[model samples]
Target: MPVYRPSEGCIHIDALSCLRNTGITIYNSAEPRRDSLEVSVRTSRPSCQLIERIESILYSVFQVCWLEPEQTAGKVKPFFYTQGQAVLNRSFFPCADTPSVKITYSATIKVPHGLVAVMSASQWHEPSADGEFRFTMDKPIPSYLIALAIGDLESAEIGPRCDILIMPPSFPFGGMENPCLTFVTPCLLAGDHSLVDVLIHEISHSWFGNLVTNADWGEFWLNEGFTMYAQRRITTMIFGHAYMCLEAATGRALLRQHIDTTGEEHPLNKLRVKIEPGVDPDDTYNETPYEKGFCFVSYLAHLVGDQKRFDDFLKAYVEKFKFQSVVAEDMLNFYLGYFPELKQQDVANKPGLEFEHWLNVPGWPRFLPDLSPGDELMKPANDLANLWSSPEVDLEKVKQIDISLWKTYQTVYFLDRLLEKSPLPSGNMVLLEKTYPKVSKTKNSELRLRWTQIIGKQKYTLPIYRALWASSETARKLALSTFQDTKKQLHINVQNYVSKILM
Candidate 1:
């Protein structure tokens, strides 16, 4: 009998076992199989005494018994974590790539004598004499969850359980890192540690996603939506409720911009969208599952009418379904069962706003969280924004409010409001630059990105957004010349985006 981790499908479970063990590992999951020249193979592992025979019962899958690995060389090099979005892990490993099944993986990765290796796993053993690092992930996670990186890495204690691994933006391979070492943009390091929210985001996933999970791509919101909700709950506690609301207000702007761009009817906007065969599930990703799903979850809290009670339900929900893959209905069923009174009242079947409608609906979220709590913070930014965006003059009022005094998100929210109200009288540009030099000079990526966007978009009418050079004649020549001098320093993505604006 072959040792297999339990997965929903027969192919997934069997193929997974044959893919990772010492005895007859499956490899080369790419290129389709050639016409079946009759072949039979039995895999065995000594400890488990696991054996399996896969016969001619086959679809097309190229399974290489001897693994082929990608190689690279460097005197002093870094290999950042690898995770192809969605289920593209097969490009690097021959493992079965499906979220429907979670796999537990253990690997002994060899590196240069002095280098370090890390995998996004629970346990790590010190490097052995032979320069091999061992890692074990007892948790069953979707294939994409496994990540590995080997480098001359160093670590610092960030928290009791958290360790900081810094990689400069110049690290070419540091595209996107997750898991054990959790790689992130260098920009998030504001020196003051104020912008490490992405770390909080990944940590939240430990419960809502890594623990319990979505069964398929269609229900990905269960992972991200819940994570977003969880992330804010944490922020609300660490910061005040007002700050959380202020920060969320910025997120709402992003969600709205995304919806407008994608056209609300796009299928990806649905909380549970269909993933057609052959289309990569990663391609279906958007803000819908995140912001819209957060709204839905937040609505549930609203229905309960007690923040404490809703939080208790969330805790109970995690307890009920940890370590399982489930669809939207599973969550709904569990929710209704947990709150019998709400179930009796038929809250889900409410008119014009049924839970089913929320799951299937497109466009704007039916319910928006009351962000008024942030108004205490938002009113200042809004007032500042109106002053800059206003046709008449109020430059004096804008100068009175210190931009530096505002927190990072407060600054971010102010800029986002400006973007929403772009095409200000060109005169406002002078006042803005003169009043808030930080907008042009700040090192904060979030603020810098927003400022650049305002410069890029302030003049172009909506749907025909263009760069600062296109409309702001005062900033045009200088912005273009600045690009000529510094564009090469920008990342390729930034270069292309800025290039588009200048064009």
Candidate 2:
């Protein structure tokens, strides 16, 4: 197909081939005297190969698949979706795949009568009566963020200006940020709303990542770090400061794990990294960008004396960079320009607070947020854990501590501490389980995962197997790690069940 850019005096010939999905070449042509130019070329649909497929079904990157029937046990129905990160969007259309290019798009999609088609644009909750759906995104976004999904879908309101899009069971990612339509896995329907944090994370991306994007993949922390910080802010608003801190602590742990595994010298550990030509951007993907970026942003907030001042600055930053792509230097320059005091050489020279040191230097940042507030809120849970860990402490006194007022995060913190030690004696495990039966029965995914970890370490085969089978896809790696270690102790039938579920 010929895509003519009369203004640029160029025509792009996009072609479909057997080996490669699509390829394009731009040729200089005489500028059109009229407002538009038209050209005709042989056109064929590109059959994009799936970058990765899970469960002998669901395809990642860009492709179509079939989802198992919702009501029928063995029946399957066609479900089409697109994941266009990196250069995958070019498979759909010939366009600049880099994040630096942003565009506003409008599309009209037609599907079967009963099916609904949605895109990362202004969309209707319900499909049109004629089965024709039209969408427009006034805000400019990179091509990778331009996604489409069509299926037997349903929606329900979660909050003001927020609704959940329930995709087929074959949906792999726990959730994807596709503007108004945030596609989520069916596993989130765990009875309890513990998985809604994923929703908050996606919503925050609307502002931090979608509105103000990183110029390229190398500055990915710009997209992730800001969104994570915003997600925490929203979580704190809804669930209180203590819950937010607990989540932040969990993220910090993940960041440290990535640093250790990937090594402190890895370029990906730095807040701002450089991507060499011909290198795939996905290789550098890790929690370092999300968590480490968050730490640096959080450090800046604290450095400016208070979160409110930092928050005001964030509002201004978003306003300044809305609908635009930026690099780390753009953000740093904005920070210095916004706060004249920060521009002083003396202020910039402070250890760990320097712009270049924080953004360019590898390893963990010298500055870390003081989580003393979280420690204070979690003192009760910590005290209970300490009592249980003490050799001379009375178990009865520990059992008597009132934990009814404790949040889910407090319970998770207590359980996490328990896992840090070697497995407890069987009798102690029994007593602990009996005292806090809710830990085993609770539907909260976070607490359940932590409780399962403790149980798995103690070699409590039954609970470990159950947790493995019930775990969310997002936690599959963690669940599998626990299962691998304890699988030998479990019954053959239980082992088979876990293998089937995870697979």
Candidate 3:
């Protein structure tokens, strides 16, 4: 959690302002002595069910769930994990609960004799025979980055000085970029190993989010949006720009889903979100930061015009702000100063395309990048979607294109396209199940998730909804959040049906 890491700690203004504006009396308004900043918090009484769980469960806000045995790395034993995406870490301990504050920490975690313990640290040392695990993070990080997982775990080396940890199906997040150890949902273990991009997303965080952090939850796009740009940059290098654009196409669809569900005017959809007094920072998490944020960064890249020059500027930007938390202004001013010609052109305030509007307004992004490059990879998926959506289907023509030949993302892309043209004729739906048997029963979670959503829109099946639910309380919370984000996009009847299930 957010334990003080040194002889001194700074109290953030957001926490103080929240107390003052939320009708709490602040006895001291002036700056206090270095040893002094006395603050009081109003704690909530846990409900009876929560209290019972607190006593008997490992369900801390750090999201340490009760251990269950699993057959991993050839042995079956108990394992449990912590998922602290957004700001869940604040619940486990007292801190400002914002991304602005950074702390350096060393931890000694003890566990059962047979289990292993890990944390988000620069270096990890195995436990002593007595079961004491020691770790250190010399670099400062936000409290949200403080993570831990304990288990009878096994690791397989994937790269030099790197080991991949396969998280359980119940892991709340797609992946967590916890410094030394990254946690990813086993759903990414799509038999063909196509979901390696999730790993790349987390690894990209080492530079974008983990190193140069957002100053507050309001500027969260700085973390995720920048990471999305970085992730695409890396993928473009590995999989070509067409494939990168294909991925961006997927992201754009998600952004549309988010806007449609939340509505363009929803408070959380704003690039610079406003966190109300005493509001949970995690409540503001949405696609706006990651996808919409990417649009802004992409626009900035276009502003520079030269890929090599923009790439150089990006390198210099990281070198300038690494190991620090920053707001949008810091990034923007730096960019303008770096490109004096663009600054002289007054590009930051170019009429409706102003940087101010991009940061403060909420809706679909104004600046759409050249995703036409994606059409090369997207055309097949788009054609297949159009073919299936047509009133009269050509079975033989569809068979000409084998679904098996497409990469994992292509299938994901194809399924996602079908979702956009949802409520396919029942006959076509049945035909889809038969023609593509793998689509019906594939173990790929990404494909399964999209397939289930498509089914949910059409039939409102109970089993399809249940598939979205995970057993752990943490996973349930995450599932609920996802439901909230996209429920508006569902038919009224289906929305009510799923709401009852969630309740």
Name the candidate that leads on lDDT: 3
Q: Model 1: how far is 93 from its true place, Å?
A: 2.0
Model 2 regions more than 4 Å off: 1-9, 12-66, 70-78, 123-130, 157-160, 187-192, 387-394, 457-503
The local distance difference test score of each candidate is 0.70, 0.70, 0.75
lDDT of 1 by residue, 1-503 (tens): 34444673333224444444444543322432211122233445433234344431223312211111221223245344454446656655645566667788888888777678777778889889889999998878777677776666677665666444554453322223344656565667766566866777777877777778888777889888998899899999998899999987887887898899889898888998887755558655668888898999999888889989889989988889877888889888988898899999999999977999999988898889998999988999988888888888676686788777878899889888888899678788777787778667888877777886776663112112344455557767766787788554444445566777777
Please state the error at residue 180 of candidate 2 in Å: 1.5
Q: Taking the tens digit of each residue's C-alpha lDDT, what string does model 3 give over 26-131? A: 2332122111123442324211111111111121332144444432333366565655556555444444545677888888888988888888788888679999
Q: Which regions in candidate 1 have their CA more than 4 angstroms from the true location?
A: 1-78, 164-177, 458-503
| C-alpha RMSD of each candidate structure in angstroms | 7.7, 9.5, 10.0
Instruction: List TM-scores for all candidates, in order.
Output: 0.79, 0.75, 0.79
lDDT of 3: 0.75
Q: What is the per-residue lDDT of model 2 for residues 299-382, given as tens digits with 9 covering 90 to 100?
A: 778768878889999999999999899998888788878888877755666865777888888898677776666876677777
In what order do the candidates fall by lDDT, top score first? 3, 1, 2
